[model samples]
Target chain A: MIDWSSFAYLAAAVLFILGIKGLGSAKTAGTGNVLAATGMLLAIVATLYLTRVVQLELILGGIVIGALIGSLLAKKIEMTAMPEMVALLNGFGGAASALVGISEYLSRQGETTGGMVSIAIVLSLLIGSLTFTGSLIAFGKLQGLLSSQPVTYPAQQVVNALILSAGLGLGVLLATSPFSELYLVLLLSVALLLGILAVLPIGGGDMPVVISLLNSYSGLAACATGFVLGNAGLVISGSLVGASGLILTKQMCEGMNRSLLNVLFSAFGKHVESKGADTANKTARSFTPEDAAIIFSNAETCVMVPGYGLAVAQAQHAAQELATVLEERGVKVSYAIHPVAGRMPGHMNVLLAEANVPYEQLVEMDDINPEFPETDVALVIGANDVVNPSARTDEDSPIYGMPLLDVDFARNVFVIKRSMNPGFAGVQNPLFFNENTMMIFGDAKNVLLELVTSIKES
Target chain B: MLDDPAVALTILVLALFVGVEIISKVPTLLHTPLMSGSNAISGITIVGALLAAGGEERNLAAWLGFVAIILATINVVGGFAVTHRMLAMFKGKEQR
Candidate 1:
């Protein structure tokens, strides 16, 4: 029966891999998710059936309670809050990994442990503890409970290095003395503290990278626990997730034109007052939604660039409506997505998808940049940094070399913003002052609604 | 199922390359779902949790395992559900 269940796990692992393969295309992504869920069901059932030798009630109770809470959370969270929700869940996954390591260690205390087993346990505990707290801090910053700015102190990196060294030293101690659970507890504390300090200096705008990195950590923690348990399914799935996360983290950094080290250490966007007053003196032509509608009506082709502000204002549906109206009026409409446009990679796509925006119309940054010059009107909504021209020209500017959406090259540009205040990086956008740019000052949703109305009327 | 640590290490390493190869091609359109889906899969640690909690010992191991099961279950369930919801909204023109 154990052998039979092992075969089931092997089959489950194959299905999990196929599930991720299904995500390769939008067409099959739904089926892939279902396949993965089926694999999960199989794995869980195999575990339960392998050991009917005892505590059924506790297992059932835990699943029921967990299912209720999990489903409720999934049902209740808004699409705009998805990033933070994912961050929070990642934290729990890491915690579970650490708990498994501890449980396994306590269960096997009477037996002599192998060197490999001891190393796996300590590594799992260390990675799990760090991931748990690191993800929590990410959630806090994303949810606005903590300051979104990079919180840095003198010699922050040096302190972080010393703490990590101390945690590794504790790992050595814990590994040598497996019976001393005290070493385990001390190592866990060091790791949790390390998670906080590691994430502390990362500004909120850089959360895409942090979240992706923590996502990787959670997976590696699971992998370490797999080694402790001698389970191939856990190891396989954990490595897949770890790889997926590392890839996404790299993607996010490339989107911002920064290295992983720079993202982690430099605390980019540390100051908010970097010549922001330049925007006040520079001429930004302000226009009303009605006036903006006239130019949009004349446009033959339009590109919509959305940002995190659009999510904050909950205007995706309105933006969709505006695009629909434009399409109805014989104007071709497509959305130009900046890779790091919203709070996370592909955030704009999620928000837009939620509003039933056609997936084909969401163009990638590299794919859409060349089309801007040929485009008639480009509408910038609730976005700033991704579309800024300074990333191309201003050498001294922090965002000097990052790729932009190139919305400035369009025949006409309409920027829907609340004020002339600088972006998250506190860099003034030359695109805002472009002769072709019209800054429409208002709340994003309100301005979008007004645009939809006036476009309908026109 | 191999009990050898070397076997597990080999599996982990091979899976890392396979994982990277499989996911490297995912288009940005579904990146959110890709992330959420992979996150849910990380809850595979639940197998170990079940083993520790399965015995009627009701000791420290059982309690910790019970707690671990619940937390991992949240990740597995919440992650998949959220991802499904997000994916459902991503309509292509053909679907509409």
Candidate 2:
């Protein structure tokens, strides 16, 4: 029977592998998700069968309650809030692992824990507690429950380091003497505090890195839990998550052209003020909806650039409608997507896809930059920092050295913004003051609707 | 199953390699789904949670185990469901 259960776990592991492989492409991603869910189901059933000493009623009730809440949240959550939802779920995973570690320790009150199990318990508590609190901070920032800006104070690094060291010291002490519940409690508290302080100084602009790193931490916690419980299924899945999340984090950091260490330590967007009072003095050429429509109607090639503003305004559908209308009129339209255009990595792509925009129309920054020069009109809809020319020329700009869309290279540029406000990075865009640039000030969805109507009427 | 730690560690190391290799070739557009999907996979801790919770005693261990089971289940269910919702939105040019 034990052999049979191991086989079931192994089969489930293979399914998980295939599911991940399927997620590599857009067409098969849905199937990949289903496959992974099936793998989860199999693992759960097998574990239940293997562990027969427990009450069936409790497990069923827990599953029913959890599934109800989870599915409801999944159904109700907007796509814009997907990253926050993911962060919260990652936190739950960490909390689960941490609890399992504590429960295991508590259950074995008198038995002398082996050296390996002791190490596993310490690691599980450390990583799990940190992941839980860190992910909560990430979720808070993403959902606007807390300030999105990096929260830093004097000696923040020193304070965080001291907390982390204290946690480690307690971990070592608990490992040497396994029955010290008080030491365990202290270690968990220090780890929890460390997690909060660790993420508090990370600015919202580097949220992708923070989220991914927390996701990785959750996996490491689970892997440690596996070691504590001697569970093969947990070990395999946990390590897979840990590695993939780290890789994803590295990829996002590279997309922003920043190192992981810098993203973790340096508080980005802190130097840039969010207020627009200083930039309001600069004159910006504003255009009415009709004027913007006329330019759009006459353009031979138009490139659309999207940013967080699009998400804020929920104008992705309108943007798609405008693109479709332009395409119907034989106007060539392509979308230029910045790597970090939205809150999370690939956020813009998800929004565009949700709007039913054809994937082929969305071009990456590197591929679209060279084409901008030939574009007749650069339609910047609710975007700022990624298109700002300061990244290229301004040495002291907060966004300096970050790659940007070359919208300024276009023959004519139309920027749809609510005001002359600086972007999240706190940098004023010089492209707005360029001779060819015209700002259409209004709500993104309203402006897009007007543009669509004008194009249709034309 | 608890006979040897080496076997579990071997599986851990191998899965890590496979995970990094598989995700290396994923396109930029699929990054979100991939993140969500792998996140769902990490919810496999649900199995561990169930085993912990179902054990014979109504002690502190059982209570903590119950909480673990619920949280892990949410991670699994929500992660997978949301990933599906997001993936369903990605359409090709022809499909659109």
Candidate 2 CAPRI classification by DockQ:
medium
lDDT of 2 at A329: 80
lDDT of 1 by residue, A1-458 (tens): 33676777778889889999999998899999999999999999988886443778778888888889889999999888888988998999999999999888887786765477888899899999899999999999999999988889998888899999999998988877748878878998999999999998999989999998999999999999888877788888899999999999999999989999999999888876665224555798999999988998999999999999898898899999999999999999999998897776677899999899999999999999999999999999989989888788778788878889999899999999999788888888888888999999999999999998999998
lDDT of 2 by residue, A137-198 (tens): 99999888999888989998888888888998898888777587799789889988888999
Candidate 1 backbone collisions, by pair: none
Candidate achieving the largest lDDT:
1
In candidate 1, how many Å is residue A264 off?
1.3
Where model 2 places Cα greater than 4 Å from the true spot, the runs are A273-282, B1-8
Candidate 1, overall lDDT?
0.89
In terms of TM-score, the best-performing candidate is: 1
Model 1 over residues B16-69: C-alpha lDDT tens digits? 999999999899888888888999999888887888788879998898989999
Cα RMSD (angstroms) for every candidate in the order listed:
1.6, 2.3
lDDT of 2 by residue, B1-96 (tens): 744767767778888999888878777787787777787788787776777678887778877888888888889888899889898888888885
The weakest ten consecutive residues by lDDT in model 1 chain A span A272-281
